[model samples]
Target: MRLALTSDNIAGACEAVVAEMIKAAQGEAMPYGGDPLTEQVTKMFAELFECDVAVFLVSTGTAANVLSLAALTPPWGSVLCHPESHIVNDECSAPEFYTNGARLVGVAGEEAKISVSALEQAINKRMGDVHSVQPSAVSLSQVTEIGSVYSLAELQEISQLAHSKGLKVHMDGARFANALVSLGCTPAQMTWQSGIDIVSFGATKNGAMAAEAIVVFDKNLAQKLALLRKRGGHLHSKMRLLSAQMLGYLSDDVWLNNARHANAMMALLQKGMASIAGVEIIAPAQANMLFCRLPVGMAEALLAQGFSFYTGRWEEGVVRFVTSFQTQQADVEDFIACARDLSTSHTKTS
Candidate 1:
């Protein structure tokens, strides 16, 4: 009856990764992503993306994102992104710091998806002037800060618009697999084929214990990431630990399976939540995240009963519940039951 759907399960790196890690420890391998497994994973990425991709593994999504942005933007330039984007808000200005003082400008849009007009405005508002930060790149989140996703057309529109402005495109794909499943598109179509120049290909949020990657679609931007990752202090000496997690995450299509389960659970919960009075679905029930509103007292009562979800960060009474590979139908049911019970009580009293 414990439903604490806040983030992905870090229950010791999933089964497949654990096996890979144990094998990695049993023998010698190159350090700093020069090992056989790293090479093989690189091939996996290239094949998965349907192009010659330059891949770099990191231990955290923030590192993957900041390092990639640093390579794409000069210190004097700026990156335009959704106001709630991880780079703009959550990463503690790491993108700006990593890029040595590049500016992070917010692009306003609905559902945290930046619109083409907003991009045009953000880019033109002092871009390429000697007195202000130049627009060097743009960053987008696949499964946006809210639950909604960018459609293929949305991605193409933004990417094409950014490129025409001489800005490279980067995607914060922390929920890459979840969005991929939701959109039913190939990785290539979701990214490079749609004009994405770089991607922070995330696995930790799906099933990996601690693994994320920067995938370079524009092959020319490849070399600098290695040095940037090392300088940023994410170059693991035992590189195979990170490599093993990604390898296993990609194997048997576990990443997609995990995401599919999470997304399915989100869909189920959204459907059930609609019937609960006073519970408002605040955002589109897309991917594995949901935004909804509950009465303040009911929220407190649910948390007191050990049903946990994010609250009070974005706004009062509105919260986000995230499903992961470990989230269960029973958990969802119990949560809904608790919320419904509290809602009933609150209504009767009011």
Candidate 2:
């Protein structure tokens, strides 16, 4: 079998998610999120966060993210985010388009996390300048682009600063489960309790096929987002399918179990790769994603050996490996063994 470690989304939908979808297909219910399944899923989210929340189900993380931003920011406003955040680098300006031209300001920071001081500077750069867009919201990526996770303390500090500056805090929780399990914190503590105003709660990366939710902590923003989602064309007519997937994912702690296993697999990879000569772990492997610096020859050899991953995205010689709920332990071991062999041969030749 090909050792696939490129992204968690490559994994097929878990059995529970598939079963839920099949079940939902058998019955005819209300359309356009007027169904009972959608309502139950909304309650599930509220309970998960330990507070009453408005949940908007969407088909993709990008939609959830941009819609949340659109609700929080106006056309003349600006959003502050880390330079390496998914919204800035990967979302293809959808946030800008959805907000009708809100600017995204990149704040420089280490380990893909925004520091409190840096965020303050960015927010205060032109507080009252008419020429510059006003800072309205700050977006943070949980299990950030480089695979590092922000601790609860870091999140609280940043959220506190943003709120003090009259800016809403939005978390792009594309790998939320992974980060949540890593921190061992409740969903509420990670979000609303940390002062986050909105969240793009993602399930597709974990196990669902194409389910994502825009979880609004503020009821007023939720009201606005309902219109934004409908306007953006993310309002699915057969919305029960998406709701079913999330229902399965969140039920019986399946999401948490899947994340724990994925994280464990990544930890194994991290330990194994660290012992290989010339393989440098470039970031903290806190969740299921890891970035490493590999020799060009080694990367090529692994690709030739049927190991699938990504390279040269962030920087030259850097590759990314992501584990999913379906990642097999044998495949991870095989990858490690292959890397060890390649490293030894290269060292001897050099």
Best by lDDT: 2
Task: Flag clash pairs in model 2.
Answer: none
Against the hidden true structure, what lDDT does model 2 obtain? 0.93
lDDT for each residue of candidate 1 in 7-77, tens digit (9 for 90 to 100): 66432456787777777788788888789999999999999999999999998899999999999999999
lDDT tens digits by residue: candidate 2, 276-310: 98999999699999999996699999999988999
Model 1, runs deviating above 4 Å: 9-12
Supply every candidate's count of residue pairs whose N, Cα or C atoms clash at under 3 angstroms. 0, 0
What stretches of model 2 exceed 4 Å from their correct place? none
lDDT of each: 0.89, 0.93
Sequence-dependent TM-score of model 2? 0.99
Model 1 Cα RMSD, Å? 1.3
